[model samples]
Target: MCGTANPCITLCAVLVGGIDGLENKLPLVAGDCQREVADLSAEERRGLRVTTKPHISIDESLREFQSDGALVRGLETPLVSAYVSIMEE
Candidate 1:
């Protein structure tokens, strides 16, 4: 699944299965770390090597899935306890 060229497929799989499905494939970073990335200045974000423009708008694609009933629910709220646990480490 990780080798697929289409990121949307990967995202859809993750969305359907929840984050636990990614436990082996990726590290579980704290939600605060994610928020910090989101809060980064545009210039700071652009400086991150992993950042790239999506070929299609992910929000729009997700909306299409919602309209088609492919996605049963929206994303889960960030796990604050998980963040605290990470901080304690």
Candidate 2:
């Protein structure tokens, strides 16, 4: 989670997906990544979410980050700094 490039990007993506789930009131389901997504039946795929959405990247995550003011002040800066350090190299 730390010392990686754009770590928040990945975290944000996941949080965005979870936000989608919460917003949509989607039910939770267990999915196996070991199996191909296409191989899963519609029933098995229900409530499953991906880190990114179609036509959107980290933008959704940025929106999510912005909405939570308290969170952004403390947590995101360090992660963003790490990502910046990676880019500088």
Candidate 3:
């Protein structure tokens, strides 16, 4: 895990990727997730390109928290991870 301690740092990012859902959860089996992956955000699509197995989908969600730079809501942790991007201000 990343260990950064800065009061001003306000972004929490989690890395979640796997094939066949690993031992964490079951594979999403409703809609054609991968077929539509090409149209997802650039970051979302990038995650799939690095996988070897082809039975998983990758997306991100945030926790129910607040910050000066960002806010995340995860009343219950979503099945997906979190993605954070910092832009020059």
Candidate 4:
């Protein structure tokens, strides 16, 4: 969560097409959620940021997920590293 004057950013790893049986469904859900948030005006959004990994999987371990070590890390990471990088901007 962000403070009053700062923007609120969220990092997510969208695990779609996994054994969870929600194959391809989570991406749609994520899209819908993003749309809802996008409906807000710029001022209302308050610099909101939403980062997602649409093709990730439930089978991925922490090391596997972060193997690329991209800004978009896995959920297992205590700190959403992407947030820190974006906030620095």
Candidate 5:
């Protein structure tokens, strides 16, 4: 099933990528929509490359979530961990 089929997985995956991007100081790439992203040439798309792991399993995503710097300040680690654990099940 697609990740979007599970809201939990979808949200967690986005969070993982966002955290990684922040830590790496990745630049943002603006695409109007899926069509705009798809219309870009291979070279153009490469410019937006933040991570090679475009799709990851929930388990992989959880590992990132459990990492020391995965979440930003103000987000309680215990709560996030509990939430992710429930989603993984």
Candidate 6:
């Protein structure tokens, strides 16, 4: 969690498809993303979450997304490695 000042999970609401919804939207499951996301000090991955709704192992889902289809579907955006730039001010 990024603290009350920034509730990142709420942001996940609209991301899931209307049908697939949370199922289709890729979330940080396990491995480095878990620690990496927790270690983040804001302005990193603003819209991050630990989702179990999909039921798929975190690592497997993530690895599946590491491919090119994830890009074509717009499910895998390039915001993970980069810092969150949007400002609330």
Error of 5 at 45 (Å): 4.0
TM-score of each: 0.22, 0.31, 0.20, 0.19, 0.47, 0.23
lDDT of 4 by residue, 1-89 (tens): 12422222222343312322353244422222354553556544544433532333322423344454432333434454443344445
Tell how far residue 3 is off in model 6, in angstroms: 17
Q: Runs in model 4 with CA error above 4 Å?
A: 1-35, 47-89
Ranked by lDDT from best down, the candidates are 5, 2, 1, 6, 4, 3
Candidate 1, pairs of clashing residues: none
Give the distance in Å from residue 61's predicted Cα in candidate 1 to where it truly belongs. Answer: 7.5
Runs in model 5 deviating more than 4 A are 1-44, 68-72
lDDT of 2 by residue, 3-85 (tens): 33255676675676676678779876654456665565666566465333332334444455555544444356676455445
Winning candidate number (lDDT): 5
| Per-candidate alpha-carbon RMSD to the true structure | 15.1, 7.7, 12.5, 12.9, 5.5, 12.7
Q: What are the clashing pairs of model 2?
A: none
RMSD of 4: 12.9
User: Model 6: runs farther than 4 Å from truth?
Assistant: 1-56, 68-77, 80-89
Lowest-sum lDDT 10-residue window in model 6: 80-89
- Backbone Cα, N, C clashes tallied per candidate: 0, 0, 5, 0, 0, 3
TM-score of 3: 0.20
| Candidate 1 wrongly placed segments (more than 4 Å) | 1-35, 50-61, 64-89
Candidate 4 pairs with clashing backbones:
none
TM-score result, candidate 6: 0.23
lDDT of 5 by residue, 5-73 (tens): 457645765787787788889877744335454355676666666224333476765676567464523
lDDT head-to-head 1 vs 2, winner: 2
